[model samples]
Target: MFDRFIDYVAKVAPDKIAIRSFEGSITFAAMNRDINRLAHALLDVIDNSSEIVAVNYKQVHIHWMLLMALSRIGVASASVSSNSEIAEKEIAILQPDAIISDTLFDIDTAAKIHVLDLNWYDQAMKRFKPDPIYTLYEPDRIVRVSIAAGTSFMRHRIDYTASMIESSVIRMITQEKISWSLMSEIPRYPTLLPTLAFGSFHGFLCYLSIWSIGGTIIMADREQYFAAIAMLSPDLMVISPAQLQLIAENLPEDIPRQDHLRLIVVAGNFPNGLRHFVQQRLTKNLNVTYATSEAGVIASINIDQINHDDTAGWIMPWIDVQVVDDQDHPLTYGEIGNIRIKSPNIVQKFFQNVQDTHKQFKNGWFYPGDLGILNEEGLLRLIGRVDELYNFGGDKFYANKIDAVICSIEGIKDAALFSMPDNDGIQQPWLAIVRGGNFDIDQIARLLEKEFYNLPDVSVLWVNSIPRDEEGHVLRNHLEKLAMQYIETI
Candidate 1:
């Protein structure tokens, strides 16, 4: 399968620049050669079966090559991003046979039997023997593992066999017809600028898919992203909604230079006004929504289907979606309930927490804890999380609703709402605001009071900024701690 992809690259634009960053650019031949060298290095690290290796590296050129090499060499590898101590702890618990680090580390307490620094390995590969042949390679038979960031007391583990990966990939490609359709629809020369860390899923997958079709993958950092967008005038660009909004808000009005760009894909929840603002400003571009992870693409929205009022667009093909009640019974279209998904790309289970694995993985469906409704037109609209809804005086209030209202205010840049424990230890909803500039708190409170009559006791606090995880999900725990500090002071 991979050989076919490599061959396609060889056939179309063999000398095209495939990957680039602040450091430099690597042509298609150089990228393929680097993959070969990395594959050999991986083979050297794990000379025996059942050897697990933990890869600790940032999202760099070498890291991407290492991942592909590990997959090619049939090695079980788990990737952890920078400053992810929780991920490191989970990796230690897995007891991998070897740990690969990009820099020196004193993780003496880890259960890993051996440590291999990647810098040394890369140097060693340059002096190694004849280059390894570009042969067909499949994912290793070893079990896959992942951590569960759910509200559960214990973390969970995920395991998927090699056959499962192959089957899933094939099923997705067949069902979505991505290979054939994308080849015709996508531009002859496409480039991507992926956000580093686990969020690279979209850019990474698109890069690989484009490479499979013999296209280039342009690497971009914060500094070069703007300049490169103008210079390269890429056929396609994948970015988050937040980043897109920043670009739209920051760009000068008279620039008028991005007409060459064909598509700009944005993911994550977006405000309606901001979406409209972008659409009005960028008249010639096609906007798309594609949300993906290490697993695969979860959902997508096309430019034509984008409704400024709705957050997410249509569900992708091959994704069996349903809204379910608390008891897991399916809800009809237009009914608000928990969003449940059944797809070949969904992770089978958690790594080691058998109980959680069993509880969460049932009948081939994964409940992601998000609440949404499917309209009569077959469009999905995410409202909020199931647990993020709070009851006040027998009335229900959603955090997203409050946040939407607060964020719509002119001075407010971002807003977060959470239920905080009162003096009686009862959970009461509290509001937090991240402002763009100084504003009258009394006026803001009046606006909220008029809108949320049932939530009369809402307390407002000004925060420097709202914390978010790598994927842009609100860091509720951090917000709760900040709320506690604020309440104690008052």
Candidate 2:
């Protein structure tokens, strides 16, 4: 798959920029040569053993090159980062045959496994020959494996083969009309919206689609979120909903040539506040997509529709989506139920997790654990997660409603609400909020009282900031701890 795109680009546009990072940029021809040399050097490391390797690298080029090299040898590649103890534990769980990283890890160095640092590997690969042999690998062999972030140890892994990768890119081009022509005078550059550690399936698909179209990938230090976008006048950008919040917060009053951005592709849950910000501030056309790590791209809704409708967008062409009840029977339109998707882009299996594999992957349908309604307009209006529903005195409600209401308030930046037992053992709602300004707790409580009558007693705590994972998801457990500590004092 890599060869098909990289080779074609190298022949037609050798000087075209393929990847640009903080350190420097590399051309298509040079990137292809480096991938070949790296693959040759990896042969010695593997020593004829067919094994999946875990690559934890800081550089964007290294991540792409390593994956390309591994694919050439028919070995699967899993990208991990040394971000947290949870991430480190997940990598250890993989027990990769070889751990190729820029920094040292705490895993046991078994004799069979090859552990090489980037500094040493870089020097070693320099002396190797650049002869790419893409024919050695079968298309059905697993090419990439990524885990769902924010799941902690439940880090469910999704395996993708070369054919899946190729098909996903094709879907992007045909379904979304995201294409680039060699005849066009304008340059098509795709800026990376997420870090390699997150390894979001949508982000990876965007990366592959951009490369397939011979477009340049612009990436920078993950820490320099706003600065990177300002520096690189990217034609297209793929960002997550969480990252969009960061962009909205950091946007300057006036940016030079900011209107040059043509498209902004967002994946994952779309919050109302984010939609409002994007619609009012950013002039670029917004494309909101609904996809899971298990399934590549399920559905999407573009700007005007997204701004107007409270749905995840229309289902993608050729995808079979069903809103089913507990019995797996399909529900009528406008009925809220569990969402199940069947598509060629769905992962074949969750590596090494038999229980999850059986529970989630059933009858060729992958249950995404989301509760939503398919409206008459054919749009999926996501209500909440089925598993996250909590009961208070036999009344069931999703915390997302609490979050949505609080976040929608004028003086609230972010908030999280979860059910917890009080001193009386009655389940009550507890809220933690990051103040956007001088928010009045009594006024907010009064507003919520109008929505849900007899709302359970809620304890509110004002915090400087809400803790979130790298993906921008609120860390519920961490917030619970803080709430507990405050409750103890009260």
Candidate 3:
């Protein structure tokens, strides 16, 4: 479905810089040629009737190239984690026809596998340069699959098709394109230097959306991101809250006023101080996007759109977002309940897992495991996860807000609110903190008092680090295990 778009861009601006990877850079025309060559070359290695191919390469740059090539062959593609254990789990769940990795294969598997090493691309190019046009894949056929991150030992698969991918790009880019200049100081094609990952859904969509307009992608490691920003003077930055914190920490005393940037912070429900910190140091033209893997960008808003607000922004007209009661009945506006979503991009259920499929998907609506409120004016306020809503001493503690407040304080690196039931089977809240120097632990009490007057007494557990997913979501299950281990040591 997207083949024509790539060909059009390659012809229109052949010399345009497409992607700048850690290894090197590639132009639109050259990248297009490589994609074509790789597609043709893979015909011999991958089975003709292959359904899924899991690519686990050390370099993310290689992952992007391989996935695109596999997509061209009308075979489903998934980015397997680099860690051997996680990669095994992902491959097991996918039950792919082929497994392609950069290292030697040792895990026993019945599927056809290949270890192509670092010189894989160079080898593939030498094999074939055929100029053959293949049939376009059906819009409904699954083209890509993403493994959802959480505390689960085995992650669930989120599948995507051409139609679903197109809807995501359209909702995230095309619809918002009209409101670009009117609402913010950013340009229509805000992709001068965007750090994107094709492994994740939103990151992939962000990269694809920018590519649709022939925008440049700068793929750098997390450590090199700040340096890349300083060097590139990026026009756009699509980053998570954790990444934003790193940026805030590394920025020099004299903040460069980048008036042209349109920084979009994903998975955000941050404190106002952190928001101000970003506007002051990074750019005032900031966009906080609240999104889910199943559904695309649900709601996003500019910094100046609201006053002292951390809302995900006004609801996107393309999506049906509702705050529903526990019984699946829709709640009235301004009431807090489960956030359920329905959109063209949404998959009704997980790819193969029946247990989670029934748990998360129901009656064509995807429950993103979030508790939130939708106001009458179409504004969405995400409180936290439904499972993270802890009741202690007759008071509720929002896990997201708890961490937001904790992490907002100076010298607090990362924080997560997790719980474990006592011997009496009563739930108790524990605040796992990864504190930096110069922050007093007592200040947490003062901050909690100001945020919630009737809050429960939350135990503070100091740890070296708090576990997190790629998007910076807290891993409660991990934290719980850590807490148990800490107790055993004591």
Give the winner by lDDT: 3
Top-TM-score structure, candidate number:
3
Stretches of candidate 3 exceeding 4 Å from the true structure:
1-4, 21-25, 108-110, 149-154, 183-189, 192-196, 253-255, 408-411, 443-456
Show model 2 residue runs off by greater than 4 Å: 1-4, 108-115, 149-153, 178-198, 263-268, 307-309, 423-426, 469-472, 485-490
**What TM-scores do the predictions have?**
0.84, 0.89, 0.91
Give the clashing pairs for model 2.
Answer: none
- Prediction 3 TM-score vs. true: 0.91
lDDT of 1 by residue, 1-490 (tens): 2323553465466687777665677777666666667677666666675445666765566666666666556665655555556546666555666766676556644434334556566685685542755544455455333344442324444444555545444543342343224333545555655543431333434545556545566666565666666665566665666666667767767656565554444444666676666667653455455343324555555555566544466666767778888889988888988877787656766655666666656788876667788876657877776667778768888777888888888788888887777779887877788988766777667877888877857777779888765445666667889988876897
Candidate 1, position 270, lDDT: 68
Model 3 Cα shift for residue 427 (angstroms): 1.7
lDDT of candidate 2 over 1-490, digit per residue (tens): 5456787788788898888766678898998888788888878777556567877777666777888888777777777765546546657656566667776556554424345667766786778887866755467867777776312325676777878888887887565563222123334445444442336666677777777777877767656755666776566666666767777787876754345454444444677667767767764456776767777677777766664334677887768889999999999998878888898757756778787777778999988777888876668777766655668777877767778777878888888876567779877878888888877778778877887666777888778888765545566667778878887897
Global lDDT of model 2: 0.70
lDDT values for all models: 0.61, 0.70, 0.76
lDDT winner between 2 and 3, please give it: 3
Error of 3 at 254 (Å): 6.5
Clashing pairs in 3: none
Put down candidate 3 lDDT per residue, 191-270, tens digits, no spaces: 54544455678777777777777777777777876667667556788888766766787887765766677778785475
